[model samples]
Target: MVEIEYKNARVKLGDPDLVYEPAEDSFLLADAALEDTESGMRILEVGTGSGFVSAVLRANFENVRIIATEINPHAARCAKKNGVEVLRTDLFRGIKPRSPEARFDLILFNPPYLPTSEEEKVPVWLNYAFDGGASGRETLERFFAEVRAYLRPGGRILVLISSITGVEAVQEKMEGLGFDVDIAGRTKVSFEELVVVRGKLS
Candidate 1:
């Protein structure tokens, strides 16, 4: 297991080779989410690799309930080790709110936004962390389709998208889905800019 500290929180990465390690995109999303997080809020983090973001929030907020989902078993284990409540399941597959009251106040996702070709794919579980299919929006499209159902009325969503993944396209898609969308934060990386897209129920 590997441990790293961020925003005063210590996170562990169990089997980094198998799980997605926290990187620039991860830190960007965490900082953006922290700007909007409030005490006593219920938050759900989809695809919480290594639980870095959620762990940061947990350490910084009091009375905040955070739950995370991960498709990778290794990631789920790593998140659990980092003191996050995580479920090992595909996006939203295992989360079924018993009532509207159980819905989350905020939802966050840092999806795999790389435009990966079949030839570029790896033969390990880590592929799920960086494989966004040919368009780099396949998994994100899936998330947009189902996320609203799990969010409470007026709840917010914060998602990270790279310029290579078509940030404007993502913002337009979210708007078309009945959200008031805007760019929350952005940072330029080596080859592309990472942006945090904030969407609110309209």
Candidate 2:
């Protein structure tokens, strides 16, 4: 196990196969978390990975209930270490908003956005954290299909996308789902530009 400090939170990580170590994508999501913190706000973070973003959310919000979901068992343990309630399941599989009387105020996801072919698929679980499948939209397509049920009437979602993931397609799918999509934040590195897209019910 290795301990790394992310933002203002101390996180312990072990076995990369079991969990996806937080990276630039995770930090970008944390930046989005900054704007969503509100007293008693109910938040759900899908793909919690190393639990870094969940930790950041819990630390920054007041009376806000945060729920985390990670498909990886090891990642779920890492999230639990951060002292946040976690559900080990696929994105939004079966989780209730922390506020029972209402739905989620904000839903955050940093999904697998890398386009990978079946030939590149491996037995490693970490691949699930980065492989977005043929068009890099496989996982996201499923996420968008079910996310609306969990969101409040005016709730919002923040998701990360890479230039390689085809941002235009993602925006279109979101728009088709009745969301007004906008880029909330963006950054450029050597190979590609990373974008944080915010979607709200129109």
Candidate 3:
């Protein structure tokens, strides 16, 4: 296990080669989450790779319930080791709310937003971390389709997307889904600007 510290939180990565390592995007999302989260809120994090972002949230919040989902087995284990409650399943597949109150107050996702083609695909679990299927919004699109059912009334969503992933397009999609969407955070990296899209149920 590889351990690293960020924002006063320590995270363990099971296998660096197999699990997605925390990078600039991860830290950016964590910062954004910290700003929006409150005490006693329920939060769900999708694809919690090294559990970095969720761990950061838990370390800083009081009475906050956080659950995470990861499709990669290695990543799921890594997140567990980092003290995150993680489900080993695809996005929202294993999560079913028993009632309206069971829904989350906030949902967070730092999806794989790389535009990758078939020929660039790797035949390993790591591919799930970065393969966004040609348009860099495939998994993101899937998440938007199912998120509303799991979110409470007036709940919020914080998602990280890159400039190359089509930020405006993502905002438009969220608006169409009945979310009052806006850019909550932004940072320019080497080649792309990462944006945190915040959406409130409307």
Candidate 4:
């Protein structure tokens, strides 16, 4: 279990059989986004396990609508239990925009980017957070391709990527996709390299 305080609200998270610290990078990324932009904008939280980010956003942004997505039903349930309206979507596939021209002003994701090992098959419990594909770039690739369609002009995307998964590879992909990317925050934990990257639609 991991605990974090975002916008003065406490959130507790537990994922069985997986080791991870929740919401630190996500909060840093979100704070950067909220600080750098004006408020009352539409926000989307991808992979919203337990609703920590969504709950914090709801508390901070008045007149803002939060659309949270979780691929795992259990996570979705947990998010809803925290008073967030969560959508069950595989990434952005099932999420429909409010209108043909509607797009999110801020998009956030804490994706599963831990590179898998050949010595072990991914455990089912880790599926909600771990199991990034061979190079750990599969989910990021999909987000890069599809997110453009859902992002407003000049909108920003904040995401967490682990150094173990090759941040440079993901950065190159985002650059190739025409995004202006920069590392907004980072923390070097004993066993993990965590960072938050902010991407602006260019």
Candidate 5:
């Protein structure tokens, strides 16, 4: 069990073997993105660790409905306890709109942007939440490839990438995918530089 305080909520995380470190960057990125959405926005939160972002969004938006996805089963269960519409998914698999007509106005993620290193002590659940493959961009690439299918016309996506993961490389990747991207916010942490990238689908 791990405990984290985020967005004024004490969230308990359960994972028998993995040590949970709350990603402050993830929570901050979600807050920044929420400012840009309207009151009734439909939101999708990817990687809903402990449901911090979902809880915050629920509090702020009166008519908002959040669809949260987690790769870890334990995390999904934890998020469900927080009143989130939680689904266990490896990335975006197993999640789709209630109807083909349903789509999200805002899609958010604070993905595992830490580049994998040989020296790091990685546990099973942490790997699902922290490993971004050899270059630390593999998961981002996969998300970008699949995002359009779930987005409403002119919908926006906000995500966090760190300097350790090569922030500029992520921007270039988004551009090559034809998204109009911008830096929504930035913060410096003890170990990494956190930035929120907002991409609008054309």
Candidate 6:
């Protein structure tokens, strides 16, 4: 187990197969979520690997109910340990409380946005956190497709994306989905430009 300090919280993460470490993408997503959410906002974290950001949100905001979903068993356990009310489901599959009151005001995801070849992909359980398929939009496309079902009337999404994933293509996809997309934040690393995209239904 490794204990890492992220933003305003210290989180303990276990095996990588279970939980993703706190990396640049994680921090970027967390910062954007914090900026977008307020006390009354209802939030849902799509892939709460280590539960760090959800914990931070719960700590920083009041009267805001935050729930997280994780597909990996280990990650789910880790999230539970950190006080996240976790749902073990693949994306939004099998989620409970599908009522309107369960609709989220904002959703956050730091999905696996890195482009990877077939050979480069790892095990299913481990790769879901980082393998973004040949174009890096594999998981992203799925998220954008399924997200509309869970969003409240004015609800939106803040997701961490990358230049490597074809930024223009992502934007085009968002437009196709009837969402007005904008860059919430971005940081350029050595080669890839990591971006946090905020999208609302148009």
Off by over 4 Å in 1: none
Comparing candidate 3 with candidate 5, which one achieves the higher TM-score?
3
Candidate 2: tens digits of C-alpha lDDT, residues 1-202:
6988865678777587668888788888898777766888888888988888888877666588888898988788888987879999989878753443488888899999999999998887788898999999899999998998888888899999999999999999898899999998888867988899999974
- Is candidate 5 or 6 superior in TM-score? 6
Model 5, stretches more than 4 Å misplaced?
Answer: 1-10, 15-19, 97-101, 118-123
Give model 4's TM-score versus the native structure. Answer: 0.86
Against the true structure, candidate 1 has what lDDT?
A: 0.93
Clashing pairs in 6: none
What do the candidate models score in CA lDDT, each in turn? 0.93, 0.85, 0.94, 0.75, 0.78, 0.84
| Pairs with backbone N, CA or C atoms under 3 Å apart (clashes), candidate 5 | none
The alpha-carbon deviation from the true structure for residue 176 of candidate 4, after best TM-score superposition, in angstroms, is: 1.1
lDDT per residue (tens digit) for residues 40-70 in model 4: 6888888887777777777676688888988
Predicted structure 2: lDDT: 0.85
Which candidate gets the maximum lDDT versus the true structure?
3
RMSDs, each prediction? 1.0, 1.9, 0.9, 2.7, 2.5, 1.7
lDDT digits (tens) for residues 1-202 of candidate 1: 5688999898887776888889999999999999999988999999998999999999899789999999999889889998999999999997996577789999999999999999999988899999999999999999999999999988999999999999889999999989999889999999899999999995
- Against the true structure, candidate 5 has what lDDT? 0.78
**Per-residue CA lDDT of candidate 5, range 57-124, in tens?**
77567788788888887777778877789888877888764543488888898888878876673767
Candidate 6 per-residue C-alpha lDDT over 1-202 given as tens digits, one digit per residue, 9 for 90 to 100: 6777766676878787557876777878888888989888889898899898898787777789898888888888898988899998888887653666578989998888888999998776768888989989898888888888888777888988888888889888887887889999899888888899888864
lDDT of 3: 0.94
Clashes per candidate (backbone, < 3 Å): 0, 0, 0, 0, 0, 0
User: On lDDT, who's better, 2 or 3?
Assistant: 3
Off by over 4 Å in 4: 1-4, 12-23, 97-101, 123-125
Clashing pairs in model 3?
none
TM-score of each: 0.97, 0.94, 0.98, 0.86, 0.87, 0.92
Relative to the true structure, candidate 2 reaches a TM of: 0.94
Top-scoring candidate (TM-score)? 3
